[model samples]
Target chain A: MTGSVLAGFPATTIRWRDQLDTPAVVVDLDIVERNLRRGAEFAASASVDFRPHIKTHKIPALARAQLELGACGITAQKVSEAEIMADAGLDDILISFNILGRTKLQRLRALAERVRLRTVADNATVIDGLSSAFSGTPDRLGVLVELDGALKRCGVPTVEHAMDHARKVDRAAGLRFDGFMIYPAPDHWQDALTFLAACKDAALQAGLDPRVLSTGGSPDMVKFAPDANVTEYRAGSYIYNDRALVSMGGASVSDCALTVHATVVSTPTPTRAIIDAGSKSLSSDLFGLSGFGMVRNRSDADIFALSEEHGHIEFADGAPAVGDHIAIIPNHACVVSNLTDHVQFVRGDYWVGEQRVEARGTVQ
Target chain B: MTGSVLAGFPATTIRWRDQLDTPAVVVDLDIVERNLRRGAEFAASASVDFRPHIKTHKIPALARAQLELGACGITAQKVSEAEIMADAGLDDILISFNILGRTKLQRLRALAERVRLRTVADNATVIDGLSSAFSGTPDRLGVLVELDGALKRCGVPTVEHAMDHARKVDRAAGLRFDGFMIYPAPDHWQDALTFLAACKDAALQAGLDPRVLSTGGSPDMVKFAPDANVTEYRAGSYIYNDRALVSMGGASVSDCALTVHATVVSTPTPTRAIIDAGSKSLSSDLFGLSGFGMVRNRSDADIFALSEEHGHIEFADGAPAVGDHIAIIPNHACVVSNLTDHVQFVRGDYWVGEQRVEARGTVQ
Candidate 1:
């Protein structure tokens, strides 16, 4: 109510006597800027254009921060999300997911009219649907064939399927076959490169140039360079390292920009404590994690379980007394961001500002 | 943008055309009302007051609707949530979470001054903290001793510890003893009830009447009702059936008032389809569930994996085509509601409206 602990207020500006509400989300802008610079520098060193995925933060201010730090573009997973960024003046978006449904396709076409929009598809049916939806449109729509690396979620299983989809995409008049896209499975860079080479061979056989090969995944981005046949990097969540990223040795807790600032509400026993943040704020995606997530300062504590609004913490060292506020780097950053409308930005001891999660609730 | 799909609209006017969007959450108001009425009626039939916990929906409108349907008071898990609901002019709130920290306690004392605020504490430290914060204040802060069930989370482990803390709270000048509160562990209801009774006996031994006996849970509500020991019910998620509740046979999918409407983006193979609704929209809390969640109408299919913004559905019954929409009942409705800003409402083929998740970011 006092707006004292609101996001973006400089921590240095507050008196030590001021109270900090528990279960609040805290974002370190210094770490966030460093992370952005590090990721952009990595892409620059690899000779690939850095187009950070905005889905992780879903805040226009953060997107602008990435662009100001030299990001070539931004990637979105939905037309509605893209529209949200586009409204905030972010153009050149690569929609990472396949766009379907007449209503959604209509929205995407409208968005393409406002911004340079690119998307992915793994089959001819989707391409045909896009073609039908964009008939008589003069704006060029970039198309990418998604490749499967180690994760078996989306994309074509093999290079042949990728080529088949690419060729079919080429055959569609309203759609342009630009290149290939792959969401790497568990940081398997070697498999992804091998798959990309196969895609190049198939494209060559079909007499098409796969000029815009995009490979993305924060875990495997370091191993992926231009020589690996990747021309663009679409890594997201790198600006805010999470527990999964830290466990995979991609980033450290110090590099984690976003943290759930939870207070110890109850210390029922010497070994147990409960925090106010739960599955809702911290998220339930384990990402193959051993526990709930990583807690800063209290690394010995394990998050045993999360109810809707309460998190059960088990510590081996000592239980945190009631009123202690601890930082938690979630298992996944993107999902955590989706649960809130805004986050506070802090610099060292100063909490300087706040930013709304502008693209939140754009579910369409 | 069409008002039909926009977030924060009132729920009395949604349209059928909005279902084309993937991963959009929907709540059935009729079923929700039915669930509320049934729960309140059952509580009345058993001669108990129903204090419907609003932590599940986090919407003041929904909480107001519940109050109109016979709920004694609304339950909140955070001071910020209670403050927001109170700001909306709704009073008689029970802050169900343990209050900690100086800044937070100051805020809690401020809140107690505004409404009939009641809260729980499990330790002597918190009781002393509250006493210090509310020193010299004439307002009475009702204090409940949170007793441990089989959950092993927050609460006093033994009856002696509970009574000892209760006596300390009774001696506090600014706080009033208000009985006991327990979040009963599923399958351990009888034992917890017996422990609570023993704690009450100890309270009586200390010359205190623990008149307020609050016990409730989505999984164990039915089991706890017959014991006649719990004088108040504090259930929340029973209003919206989720995978966990459905699996526990607490409510059916038809009784489920919450669902995510997702568009099928890709049908790459006969056995696989990708949807727009993923963990960001539907949350990944399986609650020991076998899959991510359950898809309605497409019962044979399985929602197996989520990648931030994409849900992978595997089916031997053949793939859903691109552009098709499907409904999903998340494993945990409370977490899913926390993921988005609002939900669409529908009734018998008629598109009704939208409702804002008023308490979405009230982490404190």
Candidate 2:
């Protein structure tokens, strides 16, 4: 508990194991390593290249650990995140979102020059932006056509649109069409495999070699068939399964590695208790869950709501007393990682150290 | 659009107004000043002291501007945030949240020693912790008893509990019972006023002076009676009115000072378009609103959902084409301000400068 103060506040680095602070993200090192090994083994058994997304942990140490555990590369949703991994000496990265504008393109080119950088595109405009930026570059940027498997957030709608974008990438200068990248919804593995197979056939018809058919979602990663057209699997939450993952049947509650350690600050009524962790710490991402998070070992208590700095917990039986510490598995782990600057690492019953969320707040 | 690269990524500074980047928070400086003036004028006309919460705009420059425009003092919700403001030379800060534990109490004492720091406590344990930390210290910490007006998040439940905490603060060593602070829900102003009057009467009967009666909520601040018992009003979102404020009938859409500028990245279907600003950029704080955010000047579009890095916009009419920039008024602006490291400042139509969210992640 003795550490130097940071900005007139308690140092985030906790030294004592017994005096765990409230509203701190605590990662069980043993569980995290086990989760990483399990994911790598599953991908290996299926003969798929494992590429864990750094967007989940956002910690360079954990990214390096994943690479050492047989991950082929790392996946990032933003170019800024890729740069952070690059600074941490992770050479291979995939920016799995469409990036636009001249300023972003110039930065992407610079990042590509520094690392084995690949990007995803679903339309001609984004492809044009990438192609124009990398037209005269020494290192050709690897491009992956993003196809909408089920989630219609950001991807080409049909196989024809995917092939069209792939063809554009294939014909463009200073760009190498790697393959197709699809993030499918849960239980849509058959549809995703079918789409990938058709996309591979379209690439062959167009005389383009589709080397990487990357597809993944934590819920379906372990369910992928060995003979599927997918060549690489990308999963972020597998390293630290959340309540959302557990609710989706991706992992058992025992497999959840990260927990928001919060102290109950108020017990206003028999059924209601307020925890120190709020939306600022636990995040407001429901991820289709009924509540904000799940209280570990306290199934009777439900974290039903959250304000900016207070989480409301409703108990089925009796509420926790004030000053009682409770561990919460947040609804979405990735958003929680993005919300904090550091996380406490716990080994067994002792807090070993703190990991800096280096890639946090890199929204641009 | 030319700025020095930051960690191999494009700097989040907008050089030209026309070339402003997407997925950025743009603050209308003129509108912000007007909002500040309007709020200060409203509080002044009611003879109530105005204390704007820094949780809305974490930037110290904006906080100083608010102080310059007649804000009595600044309010912070966390000890870490108060420390940041103290570092920026804000002399008076009221941390309007119950702080517990040895580490936080020590930090609170240090902050109080440096500045005129007052904190809220609803229970005796918290007051005891504060008293123990401040015992034998030169500066006594001002303590406010929090009353639960309507929000059951963090406050004393009944009048008896309020008086009990107030008496505890009055008798505690190295503590000054300043007054009462209550965050009343909209339309519950009468109840809060009555509660404050009762507390004031109790304090007088106990031979103690209740000098400050602090009550605030942006939605109901405009409806406070001139002769109300509230001596001061605290508000955060009034400085930069948001969609939630508009929906609550607090401010007009034209009066909103903050807007999230995002680029249309995808138009997968006729009715579906995706913006680059997702939960990471705009945040997922619905604040009782129907959607994630309101697309400014585009009533035809509804930002119904968000992923980690993309916003799903369902359009009633024709959607905006790819690469088009759209302004979004987020449901909760405070959460949006906390998500980003920096925000773009706009004066009229020109890009002026960038303001760093200094207290962005100070959520301890």
Candidate 3:
């Protein structure tokens, strides 16, 4: 709000940890490092490639830290994000989402020229678009067939359908047939493993080498290890476990690195108090969860609803007074990271600095 | 997604309207102008001050246009937003929400020095905060006692409680009691009117002058005119009536000036199709609506679900093919504006330019 640019931490000798502007996303750097190491250690123990999805934090420094912690590469959901990461010197990147249209394809081709870029496709339409865009380019685009294991958001419906798309990529002059990409639900890990194995077999029978079987989900990754079917694992929200991760038994609340630091701006009644954080900050991504978000360390209170800039909380007793700060664990942390331009980094109540969400608003 | 900045419309001779990137918020400039003029005229005929909430569009040019078309000033929900408008040379502004904390109070005091600013408070704590922040300043801060008519998100619960806060503002060193502010639901307009009158009477009896009785709601504003109890009206979403407004009979589908222009990326089945517009673009504000969004001109289809970057649509019969553009009327336009950084401005079928959402991410 001040006309002055947000220049990291304030220059005052006083600690600014407790004086952060309300409705700000505060990251616990200690938990973030622990999460990064935990994911990397797990993938190393399983002897599989770890590609941390940068779409979660969207912080270039965090991605570099992940790489330094032994991650093979980073994954992005949009080409604009990959472009930003590439500019940040993250050369090895995989855009996990499908790319369409000439504008996005041109951007994708430019990104492919700068990085070891791999993209996913589930249909021939997208494969053809990629082929047309990268045919004359020097770098052959790595195109993986997206398989619909359980999350029916995007991807081919069946293994045979994925094989069809894989064959199309194999036949395209400018495309290289990467194995497959599947984001499985927690309960569908077995199905994802089975379908991915079938895809690998189908590609081998068609004389195409299936190099990377990329499958990932934060919850499923916690339950199932990377097996022979999956050559690499991709997970984003594990970097900042949220309430959704806790509900899915992926991690405890202690593992949550990201918390929205909000102030109780109004205690309108005996039971109701309003925080400054709202859907615009915490986001409306319920992810099948119940309330808007969970008040950290305040199990007695409920963030029942949210308007654009107000979070309505109801307390059982001892409601927070105005000017009190409350830490809120949002339902989904990835969306929250995308909502803000910068996040305050902290280390055990000590303010470290502010990290720019470099990939925020990179929605293609 | 392109690395190149969105240089307004493309300079090439080729038509760029059909080639626009997917999942872009496109505003019909003609309809925007018409909606602005209509709202201003309605407020004028009703003989009440029109303070359009800038949270809906967040574009400074549109806010300036509203002021030129007889809007008295602008209303913002956050101090950060008011700062942006004030930076754009809007002198008269009302931040219609509670402000707390030294960080925000310092910013508020700085903003008050540059503009004629008014803020709302429902609790004594907030009034005290404002009083302490402005006691020594040359400018007296205008404080409005927010009343809880029906929207219990924030505000004092009773007229007497509001009068108590008004008296506190009157007694404060550098604060002026500026009547009351109430955002009522459509069904509670009568209650809001009655409560405002009671508060006004109570303040007058307490030897305080209630100058501004600001009552606002887009749905209620369409059905009820500002009467003697209310001196001004504030409505934001009326400028770009969304699906929630259409369902409430506030505006017809044709009156919606804002539409998310998205591309059908995939048709995985006979009845199911996927669009590029997802929660990041169209937003997840159902506002009690059934679906995430309504596909314009395709009433038979429903945007039933959304992932982070994909909208799932199921058709009754026909399905859109890949690369087809669909205009989606989001459940709420204000959140969508906050989601995107730029809105494609269009005139009928012709692409005009891009409007920067200057107030986007101003959720301090």
Q: Which ranges of candidate 1 are over 4 A from the true structure?
A: A1-19, B1-20, B225-228
Positional deviation of B177 in candidate 1, in angstroms?
Answer: 0.6
The CAPRI-style docking tier of model 1 reads medium
**TM score of chain A per candidate:** 0.94, 0.94, 0.94
DockQ of predicted model 1: 0.60
True lDDT of residue B128, candidate 2? 85
Q: For candidate 2, give the lDDT of residue B238.
A: 93
Write the residue-wise lDDT of candidate 1 on A41-93 in tens digits: 88878888889998888988788778877788999988888999999999889
* Candidate 3 structure quality by residue, lDDT tens digits, B1-364: 1121222333334354676897788888777777877787789888899999999999887888778787899999999999999999998999998998888899999999999999999998899999999999987999999988666698887987897899889999889998999998659888888999999988888889899999988887777764888899999999899999999998899999999988887777878888888888988888988999888898899888998888989988778888788899889999999989999887677777777999999968
lDDT of 2 at A351: 61
* lDDT at position A310, candidate 1: 82
CA lDDT, candidate 3, residue B17: 66
- Which predicted model would earn the best lDDT? 3
| Top-DockQ candidate index | 3
